[model samples]
Target: MSTTISTVALGDDIAALPRARPAPPARRRPPLKLAALWPRVRGWLLAWPVPLAVLALWQLAASYQWIPAQILPAPLTVAATFVDLFNTGELQSNTLISLQRVLFGFLTGAVLGLALGVAMGLSPLVKDYLYPTFKAFAQVPSLGWLPLLMMVVGIDEALKIILIAKSTFVPITLNTYKGLQGVPSSYIEVAKVYGFNRWQMLRRVVLPAAFPPIWNGVRYGLTHSWLALVGVELLASSEGLGFLIVYGRQLYQLDVVLAAVVVVGAVGYALDKILALIEARLLRWRRDAF
Candidate 1:
């Protein structure tokens, strides 16, 4: 009877204990796409001072004999090299050649990409026929095509231009296709309600909406094409900045290599900034609408 009473007492104590409540559902944080890109903008703002600082530091180190001068020339040496090359007209010629190649290649590729993208967006048959094949092509890096291109074009200006064009074409085509495909149904409905015919709907409703993304793709394509152009030039060329780097390496002049690198980076940054300016102007509607 005592054991039975003790068991009943333990049961009462266990029944009196509190049970745990389930955890409250976690609240999801909102997306911060634009704001997350703010840090990159800030870094861009800080970029101009970097090269200057590097120059000053290098000059100080070289003057103090902290390292061999040939290994890392003072910024003054690089400047003198620059001035000498400029006066000799070699720099001007090489730069012009590179610019011409870029212009020819980029314009050709961008036009084709735009046309192809439009066809894909408008014609289901074309999309089904081309997109899968295009996706496979995109998997091959630009550098991977260099040997094949050289065999066909024989390491001449044509090879460089063709490589640049290929680098530009794929991204532009892909982005443009996506941009057109993603236009909201609401916009189409509004156009229809306003009695827009097919051409009217496309021109007034679709084109403007798609332009910004298409332009962005072109900007990226330009960047990639420039990089590919440099690689191609480095491998086989008599002129251009890529050739400049290769020439410097062959002559064992680190200063010239560094100078060429600086030039390439500066040119790329300038191109991007120009594109950004254009984007801001053309997409003013985005600022208002968003």
Candidate 2:
């Protein structure tokens, strides 16, 4: 009995003593490297060494006997030819012609596509009436239209412009239609709840929401227009970059052909870059809020 009482007292004394609390956990620090991502990403802007090196290698190969000059012209020869063409104003004139064709045709196509796509996207009647034919037309390669269109329009600028319009039209129409149609039903409901009139809904709600995709369509249209213009010129025209390529071939000047090809690629890249910049600027708000 005495031992048990002593043990109980000892336990009570231990329980009465204050216990130490676990030390508060040390605060964790976020990693510093995460803040440096943007600079690293920006580093991509300076990574042109690879492509420049490749061009240098190509120039060297053609300058020497590694590749026959006749088959593959030296970079220097191409540069000289480009300079000559530029100096004589042949390059400028031909480029202007192509630009005019693309501009006129693309404008026409964009206007028509926007109208038609907006109508069709809004109304099932228009969609049902137009979609099948549009899809059919879109499926046929732009090159295939060359022969038939040439018959009616002939080997003139008119034919080339018309062909480019055809190429630009389909994608623009399809993408615009899709973009407008893709507007959420929830948005429509909100517009309705706010008692917005049809015109107001179209101007304020549908267009702004659909603008991005429509812009994408326009970008695609420009690209196709360039390609079609090239094809038409190559097939049967006396001027433009495509014809320059043909002209070079007829005279056995592969360097001219190569130079012309390089110009085409560079122009296309420039257009794409321009469009990308536009897209980025337009979507700046979306990027920020998201």
Candidate 3:
């Protein structure tokens, strides 16, 4: 009877002790749709303030004529001129021509750069023989080559394309060689342990490892190509966005010049964004790998 009472007392004591008060039901998260959208909204909010402020300042400046109208046209005036050029199809035609030149030249330069970079990266003998001359060649700007090239290729499409290609080729080749050289020795050792043949090693290991840098090179190459195209057009062409700028300046139409400049900036930004999207898509695996 005493033992039973003691057991009952112990149970009573245990029951009297404080309970954890089940962790206040975990606070529910916001809905998935709201969660996903908030970041983009936040990003826009952060991004717009500076640009909006600049636009407002520009408008104020133009309205007050703080800068001469002939030098710094109003934003509205530039927008109107842009619309006019678009309506008359001048903008479209010139932009198309510029795009064609960049695409052709970029492709040509990229292929050759890849071939040469790969060869040099794989063979010390080739690198030793070619790298010195290539470095010296790259030190000279595209404009520096213009006179010599014009003398040889003449003032034609060939001249512009060659100049653009030259601008692209250097970055692509340098980046590709550096990227390949940077691949970790451990990766090569692992591949060797796995008995990966040369082809397999290159295809499965080297390229993937070096892809980010290679892609960077490609992006920079495209940018350089675009810049080179504009420069070549400004110097020699009769019909391109660069020509539009030249025509505007010749007529002393600051608005037209501003409009063409805006188009050039917008197009370049769009191209870069497109490339960024592609890079993100291609590199998705890196996120998972880590």
Candidate 4:
């Protein structure tokens, strides 16, 4: 009778305890479209603030006349000048000419740089014989060579191309040589252990290892070529974006100068971005390998 009483008390105590409630329905996520779109939107959001702030500051300065309009024209004035140039087809033609020169010069320099770099990297004798002369040559700015090059090639397309190529060549050759030299000795040893021949070793081990720096060189080479092209145009050519800047300054049309400057910056940024995309694509394998 006592045992039954105790059991009944225990049952009552159990019944008095709170029951477990079900979890609230899993919170629903937003649609997949929105999820994917967020990243791109976020990227733009992150990128836009600086430029927007600069624009605001520029507008403020213009409105307040903090700087003379003649020296630093309003942003809108520059935009109008850009539009006018575009309408006249002057901007497009000049831009195309600059692009052509950069491409031609960059290609020429890149090819020669690759060859020279590879030779120096692979052959000690070649490096020893050429490095001193190359270093001295590189020390001289492209402009320093102008007087001599002008005498040799005259003030023509050849002169501009040679200056641009020289500008490109130094960086490319240096990077390529360093890249090749930087490859791990262990990697070469491993390749040799696997019986890799010269071609096989280079193709499978050396080139892959060195490619990143070589590609970097190519990108730098292009940038150097662009800078050289602009300098050459400014001093010599009657046509091209650089000349436009000179023309605007001469006429005291600061807006036109700013417009041309804007275009130059935009083009350089775009080219760099293009090269970056290509680099990312080509080096995707590195991500997996690591």
**Top-TM-score candidate index:** 3
Which lDDT tens digits does candidate 2 get at residues 194-251? Answer: 9999999999899889989999999999999899989889998998899999999999
User: How large is the C-alpha RMSD of every model relative to the true structure?
Assistant: 17.1, 11.6, 8.3, 10.6
Q: Report the lDDT tens digits of candidate 3 across residue range 114-188.
A: 888888888899999999999999999998999898899898899889998998899999999999999999999
TM-scores for all predictions: 0.80, 0.82, 0.86, 0.84
Question: Which residue pairs come into collision in candidate 2?
Answer: none
Candidate 4 regions off by >4 Å? Answer: 1-46
Q: With candidate 4 superimposed using the best TM-score fit, by how many Å does residue 115's alpha carbon deviate from the native?
A: 0.6
Q: Please provide, for model 4 over 1-290, each residue's C-alpha lDDT reduced to its tens digit, 9 standing for 90 to 100.
A: 99999999999999999989998999898667988899999998999999999999999999999999998889999899999999999999999999998988998999999999998888899999998999998999988898898899998889889999999999999999999999999999999999999999999999899999999999999998999999998988888888999999899999999999999999998999999999999999999899
List where candidate 3 sits over 4 angstroms from the true fold. Answer: 1-40
Q: After superposition, how far is residue 156 of candidate 1 from its true place, in Å?
A: 1.4
Error of 3 at 213 (Å): 0.5
Task: Between candidates 2 and 3, name the one with more favorable lDDT.
Answer: 3
| Residue pairs whose backbone atoms clash in candidate 4 | none
Instruction: Show how many residue pairs clash in every candidate, following the order shown.
Output: 0, 0, 0, 0
